[model samples]
Target: MLGVAGVVVAGAAAIGHLGGSDSASPTVAPASAAPVDENGVPILSLPEPDPVEEPQDTAGKCRADRGDQKSGAGVIAAFNFAYYNQRNGEAARALATPTSTVQPGPELQRFIDAVPLGTNHCQKITALSDGVYLVDLSVMRPGQPVDRGTQTVTTAHLDGRWYVDAFT
Candidate 1:
């Protein structure tokens, strides 16, 4: 009877040794608590997307050459073509003065917003002075009658280039 009891004790010890050690078990990380509102509803927070930068020049090449910039009528033609036809504000701004309203800002945004749904064509350019001109514009808006009006455009010669000084 004593020998049988010793054999039983040895067998139990062998089984316990085969169970596994603490290091053999996989470690599990504790879950973090999510953010909640007053009613315990989870609140989601996302990061803002980055802004896209527009190129200074486009494939159409709306910028006026030196000879065109030398003439007020030419400059106005190029500016109107770029601003009203192509809807290229940057290209139009290149033909404007540094302090002109066509610069990239709220003033420029207003012009961009006011662009017609269809197209604008320069009809006639009458020289008011050596550096100024009266431009006759034909505006065509979608689902609207064609409208014709005249605007005063002033030009300035700077650094061997002519820039639109003021437009009204």
Candidate 2:
């Protein structure tokens, strides 16, 4: 269940072959290209494929501070929906864990008033230990369309600081 080929040897021997097992069905090249020259051959201006570089996370510092699960889950995912959208129990008791039971009071203020607290941008990070982390909340609408549902937070160590012990 796999076939692939691209061995276009024109003057050494082989000629053409292409796919052979990968459920081949891809070739679609042709929109305006045909002309040869310059000690080479076929050339109509086909050169534009090299611009994909998005893989951050370079780990830069660590001398000894003891608390920064990405700055403590970016301060409890930036105040979880602004205190559950104004139900403001002093803004969810200032970022959860007053014996946290999140949605045990008023359906957590009607589930943070039915979706509408999006805009996370998700810079992606996932260190599960050594202080724990998993921030990815995907949902930035600066240009519209990104309202996924990928929230997560689980930091703890109350008293010395680390907050957010569960965001779901």
Candidate 3:
């Protein structure tokens, strides 16, 4: 799992140097405001997730709920949907900060592009509070046609939402 996360993050970094594709942004609107209905009505309060089940606490909002053993599946799914849907331009604009940069070279870029194609999935999580975590995203590298990786992430509670600060 850790192996997979490493691959995904390093890969993204690599591709990033080719230039952050405007398409690499996320589709979802920032989760800062409120959970709105289709009609745009605001949702006040929602139930917190079961710590034993979800581990992530919903006392806050967005992807802020995170704890040990958490899969970060939400992050993975959301990121994929956003980028794959072509909503990545402005979404990535938010990451244009000093924290966003790639190292480990172009192998990192190929690693990212090769990630999803490898059938890697989030295996487990190690929570580091303040919306940060170590996510294990990988597939069985049992000599199968697959690649693996891990990512050390730092997420920030910004605008009442969890925004990825950095991944490496």
Q: Give me the candidate number with maximum lDDT.
A: 1
Candidate 1 lDDT over residue span 1-168, tens digit each? 999766666665565566653343333322356688999987766688798887443212333222257567677777777777667777778888888756774456577778666654545677778888776667677777878787788898889888888878
Candidate 2 per-residue lDDT over residues 4-61, each given as its tens digit: 2233222112211232435324444454576768876787666899999985442332
The sequence of per-residue lDDT tens digits that candidate 3 reaches over residues 1-168 is: 999766766666667656755655333333369878999999878798767755444322323122212233344334433333323434333332235443232444444454344242323446766556666544543347534456776655544444545677
TM-score of each: 0.53, 0.23, 0.36
Which residue runs does candidate 3 get wrong by more than 4 Å? 1-73, 80-99, 102-120, 139-146
**Over 4 Å off in model 1, which ranges?**
1-67, 103-110, 113-116
lDDT of 1 at 137: 69
On a 0 to 1 TM-score scale, where does candidate 2 land against the true structure? Answer: 0.23
Clashing pairs in 2: 2-21, 2-22, 3-21, 3-22
Worst 10 residues of 1 by lDDT: 58-67
The CA lDDT of each predicted structure is 0.68, 0.49, 0.47
In TM-score terms, candidate 3 sits at 0.36
Query: Could you tell me the TM-score of candidate 1?
Result: 0.53
In candidate 2, which residue ranges exceed 4 Å CA deviation? 1-79, 82-93, 96-127, 140-143, 147-154, 159-168
